[model samples]
Target: MTDSKLAIIILAAGQGTRMKSATPKLLHTLAGIPIVSHVLATARELDAAYTVAVVRHERDALVEVIVDELPNGLVVDQDETPGTGRAVEQAVASLPADFDGDVLVINGDTPMLDVQTLAGLINEHRHGGASATLLSAFLNDPSGYGRIVRTPDEPEQESAADTAARASTPLFGRRVTDRNGRVDRIVEHRDATDSELAIAEINAGVYLFGVSELRDLLPQLTMHNAQGEKYLTDMVELLRRAGSEVTVLPVAESWLVAGINDRAQLSEAAAKMNALIIRGWQLAGVTVQDPATTWIDLKATFEPDVTILPGTQIKGATTVARGAIVGPDTTLVDCEIGERAVVKRSDATLSVIGADATVGPFSYLRPNTILGAHGKIGAFVETKNAQIGDGSKVPHLSYVGDAHIGVDSNIGAGSIFANYNGVTKSETEIGSNVRLGSHNVFVAPVRIGDGAYSGAGTVVRKDVPAGSLAMNVAPQRNLEGWVATHRAGSAADVAAQAALAPQNAVEASAEQPAERTGE
Candidate 1:
């Protein structure tokens, strides 16, 4: 629910040409979420009266995500005018015309802008009682950003250089009274002179302004810069001229407001976010064995004493209980890992592993799979929509799909719950203490009763009664010399002939021995 105190306007209409992708720049994923979501998350935390997204490029796609992420959000489309000022003007118009609260404007591309920093800016502005608060940062190289020029510290003792600067731009000449070190104006990098370009302080593109102050000054913006666009930075000059105190907040870390304009920046932000998340988890008593190789989405939760091993990705609201150890290469998506469960080298999605359960050395658990306490979905096994009861083990090299196995049952290696026939898929049910043997295929719609045993190489198509055994038993037959005949001149044939030579010699000796004894 929105309340009347703050209105956050996220400017997302810019077409990011440097990103060079078919997908809209704001839709690009950063730390497992869209870039705009990072800024939107901050807005939600602020409990703003109006959360407005100003969009022009990829409007439909951007709106879909916006509506999904924030159901009550207001969306405004910027008109044909190509400027940040115009984008924000359209957004502010969408809100209540009489909203006399703070208007927090932020760029859509800066994913590193967190809720705490923004809240701090808002708090500082509110307490300081400024008409507008500007976020600024001093960079070692402020090459491509607008430089922030402040009014003279001593208004009465203006030097010759200062007078020339104030006289050169109409923005500086708008002052009617004495100004004492307020943010005078922002000079665009393309428009700045040599000395102005040397200024290390750059405008951070974030602003907190009184709605009335912002509304009043927005119309005064002019398209006189290199791009012939009414830059939002122009508001600093306009606000100062209107006798409004523009508070400049020099952020401690400039990266907090850094914009992601290319693939390199995207990856850089992701790495920094991952490191921050992992460090936070570690501080909360979760052991991350390899922070460099591990990643976790924002919605994932963990209990204390959980050990996250190397190459683990906990994605999408996954929860790991205390004493659980995940990975050494594992990916879990929207799954729940119970207490003391050990999941190694596995991939599971939307599944539940109960307490003390063990999964994988290469297991693939599909959605709806639930392993009960002390159960094992072991090496090379794949399970889908299967419910494994407590203490049951599907130990190796098996595919168990659309099946339910009761407690203490063991599914043998190379076994498959053949749940699908051509037309539709069915299910297999194995009862308690059942021993399903090696190479068995449980044809769908079949059930094995309690205490039953399935013989090796069995194909179970019918139900087995309690305590009964099921097998497709057949008599063993030997095709004598089959390998020698069929595999002629091969290794088997050579070995067969070598064995026959000894027997042939023994038979000859027996046949000749009688004649030799008689002689």
Candidate 2:
């Protein structure tokens, strides 16, 4: 990089008319971050002394995002006179006067421009001793891009003999340059002549200029162009006219210089960004089962040897420790997964799972839910603001909230911590080694002590001491003949009659013997 002091000016003033939506183009997100945020972050990576972003359309919204991303950065609104040159001028006026550092100017919508390229461009500028440096790309169909006009000292010498060779040569996407060392001028596609339109080199909307040089040349710009705007590209011509070296840097990875102007381009840029992220994780010793189906956030992280399964979205600062297996249809946001734990087909937010804990084949863990080591929150379970101790298990089909369960406790299937009493949400505490039966409901503000047992169908409303067996106090009763009576002449009645016939005959025989003896 350059040893000189550096600052950056980001152009975000365009209306993005082609995006055709109410949301500002810079606010549209890819990989969970606003687009200009990516550009700001990349710019900050250069360790610039200061950074300024210029905004016009949607200035307030763009300013909010920029301040959040780069808190110390400056945001200046461009005045009504429209042009990229005017935007940079407004940004430059915000910086310290007499600051003779190199200023990097870039478009905010071009988020895919990486830091390495910017650093290389700065190095080229400082080492080449050029007055201004611009990044350029060679596109196969460079329509709508401003064409780079090299000095005519080197004209095309394509002879008839080599015409076949020139056609056969592939220029699909590669950087080719000449030793001209300077560009004469730049022509926008709308204003270019037929001969100039055939040029493959196009401006990439990234430039490096000496601060004094930019401050000198910007005021000379006029609204004489087709758009009646003062274009920043006109500076290249102004610098050349003053006998200054206006150098151009050709980037080999052209997509790094690509700009996002519409929905289709946004999608393409997203795919390219995701591909880079996935490959980075793969190279870092994390196993990604299906890269195509997984979406990992820029803030999310994984330790070495973690396995990420398919159809998963791990977003918002979520961290998975070593040896953890996650996904195969799961979403986790801002959560922590401990070492060797397995999370399958679950959705959790703002929660933490301890080491070796098992969560879900289908579970919902809401905010503040924390499971201790070796704890299991199994299939179809939902938990919120609950703390379950080590070796405890809420196996299946339960809703646990505002509760704390001690170590080695077992919460049976279909049990619920009835914490909400229509208005007030209450708490439930089950002590260590408790055995809670299926279908039990713990009405809250209640506690079950250590080594206690609760029978099935019990609704616990009060406290139970240690070593006690709590159950409903009602005695069991038989209502055997009620179904037959209520369902008379039906299947139950017929079966009941058939069953009583033989018994009735035996009773009659005994009665007859008794009668005979009496006589």
Candidate 3:
């Protein structure tokens, strides 16, 4: 690697008319992160001495995001002279006057660029001692891209591998060299002649420049192109004319430097980024059953042996520990899933599931809910602002909110902690070993002590002492034959009459079988 100090300049001033949105193109998101944020993160990985973002269109919003991601990064505004050259000039002007280092210029829209490639580019530039180095790639169809023009190599400079490669297939671009073998300038497709248009090698729009040389040449840039913009590609020709070496490094993987200009390209980039993230997790011992349907945010973390099923989205600082199983259809946001925990077919946010806990076949855990180890919030359950202790269970068909349940408590099916009254919300507390029966409702501002038991269908409005049993059901009473008297011919009356008949009455009726039914 080069020992020279590195500065990264990201150009984000383009008004992406093709994206057809009010939001700046760099602010658009891919894989739940802003495009510019990804580029900034890559630059940080390279440990650049100074990182600068040049913004003009949507300047304030773009600068805000840049500062938020990289608080110490410098932000420069490109002046009204719209061109890539002017953008880089503004960034160069922001740097310290005495700074002399290698400058890496990249597009804000290319989020897929990686640190390794950039390090390699810097090394190549330094090794060759070139004034300027261009990153180039060979595309099958090089439409709307600037074509790289390379002068033929001298026989003495050509290696055996280069000779064989060039001889086997006609090289992508025409071999044009002056008397001395040197690279020519890159020509935009519109400016190229008929023969130049056939060249497949295109400029990838990423460059490494010697800072002192670039600063000197920025003033000489002229807007003589058909688009009426000061072209950065012109620098290559100017450096060559100055008797300085210009180098070109062909990137093996073209996607690394591909730029996003429109919606279709953005989507394409997103898909590629998602695939790359998924592949990384798979290599790290996390099982992603169907990578296509699973979306894991860049900020999320997963430990070894975590299994993520299909249709799952883990987002926003969520972390899953080893042996945890999440999703067949689940979304978890800002939540933590502990070791051996299982969360399936559920949506949870801002919660924590302790080790060995299980939640959902269909459940919702809202903000501030904490489920302790070995606890379960079963199917059709919803919990909010609740803390359930170890071994506690809200089995099914229940809502427990603003509540605290101690260890070993069993909340029965069809039960609810009625935390909200008409006026305001309150909390319920259940101590250890409590048995809350089915269809029970514990009204807010209530507590059930340790070993307390509640009867089925109870409505608990008051606190129950330790080891006590609480029931508020009305006393049972039998209004004999009331249904028969009230509705003579109804189904209730007919059932009542049959139930009232004696056991011997059936035997007696069988013995007298000859009676006329019509009568």
Candidate 4:
């Protein structure tokens, strides 16, 4: 068997006390994935001989997640969150017994670390004849970072007692009167003088160490600091006393070592990572309009020539294929967009849009909704649990829920497959070439046969036979000559009343004889 030389140790054992979260801090998601996942992905790109993650808090959940999702890697439990030095010691137990090659030590929260930069640091360490090499950077604000110290030259000793005195106050620690000025001893930020605090160079918390050298020096670390923690920085001083060479290589970018301990910092890191992804995609022919308004999860895929317009948030395992256009303002979750499909101003969840299909300027495709090839879901449409057939059109003002539209059918404006009847939902199936009119409602469990025509305002309750026109309204009739008969009866009654009126007047005059003579 060929001998493998390199092993990677990831420092993930910290509980992230500053994070103050119930979820393991390393398991916290950034851009739709756990933070440690990004770190593991970066390490995998290096093709290290072995990868070992040092885990402490929430070990079981982290193990399951890493083992199931992450590439094959080893996990070692630190059991106790003692310190970074102790964490590495625990992981070292899992390394091969006779391993003698270089080791890469990295922090799990530093996902921004690029494998190329890490590889370059390791290469420099191997060539510098140094026992260890640190990935260092000069930050304008280096408050919490350890400062890198280097040895200059040895001073002449007068005698053995003098050597003991000088050893008590090493020449490296003494202020050197150089041509420029007196050089102060390199000190950590907490213990540094005001002048030393002004120094910019800092440890990046990433290291490349020779395995044998680390094995020898790890046990020498003591818990002597104010925090009662075994600091890895103190090992640098120890190695110096042992006459071993240590080098610091400034990281090409300072953000490579940035770690997240709080929500705000996590957000900042996520934004930076997303910006990197967007820039890379832009350089690769993917157009992301208004990058600030667009948020693409890190794992989401966009093929070449795909355009993501402003206000588009493609997240949660979604992928848009080549030539597709998504959103002037749209949200997609766990979805797949086919080639050249247009999903505009829509919200889709667990949905798939087929090739060349067009989904609306105002539409919602809920879970289990699938649009067939070249299907159109026009403006103000909503679909749930529906399967739209190929070349079918569910145009304006429609809710196609719990239904299946056959190929090439035209679902009219204001048409609704009213599949819910208070208690349960059912399916409405329309065959090919069925022309549904406006204001049509297909009640639950009804199938419209092929070539069936429904007039406007048709409420289809039952299945219509093929080639039949189903109308739900009654027939109308016209009435004539009815008014003429009623008018003739009124005229005859008026003449008979006039004839009776004269006789009545004569009888009245005879009843009063005196009045008759005067007439």
Give the whole-model CA lDDT for all candidates, comma-separated.
0.87, 0.88, 0.86, 0.79
Q: Give all TM-scores, in the order shown.
A: 0.90, 0.87, 0.84, 0.80
Q: Sorted on lDDT, highest at the top, how do the candidates line up?
A: 2, 1, 3, 4
Q: List the residue pairs that clash in candidate 4.
A: none
> How well does candidate 1 match the true structure in TM-score terms?
0.90
Question: What is candidate 1's lDDT per residue for 1-519, written digit by digit as tens?
Answer: 554889999999989889999999999987678999888887788888889999999999999988887789999999988899988888888889778889999999988887777877788788877888877766677889888886666244232244333431211122212232367888999999998887776788999888887778788888988999979888888887878788777666667888888898898999999899999999999999999999999889999999999999999889999999999899999999999999999999999999999999999999999999999999999999999999999999999999999999999999989999989999999999999889999999998999999899999999999899888979999988898778999988888889899998988888874444553
lDDT of 3 by residue, 190-278 (tens): 88887777776678899999999888998899998888898888889989889998877666666888899899999899888888888
Residues 85-160 of candidate 4 have per-residue lDDT tens digits of: 8888777778888888988899999988887778777776677677877766656677876665444443321221
Candidate 2 wrongly placed segments (more than 4 Å): 1-4, 20-22, 155-175, 192-198, 474-519
lDDT for position 422 in model 4? 97
Candidate 2: tens digits of C-alpha lDDT, residues 1-519: 433489999999999988898999989987778889899999878878889999989898999899988898888989999999999888888989968999999999998998888988888788888999898876777898998888878565222243223321121121233563479999999889998888877889999999998889899998898899989999999999999998887676668888989999899998888888889999999999999999987888899999999999988899999999998899999999999999999999999999999999999999999999999999999999999999899999999999999999999999999999899999999999999999999999999999999999899999999989889988989987786768988987898889988998999888874334553
Model 2, poorest ten-residue lDDT window? 167-176
TM-score of 2: 0.87
The positional error of residue 324 in candidate 1, measured at the CA in angstroms, is 0.5
Instruction: Give the CA lDDT, 0 to 100, for residue 402 in model 2.
Output: 97
Preferred candidate (lDDT higher): 2 or 4: 2
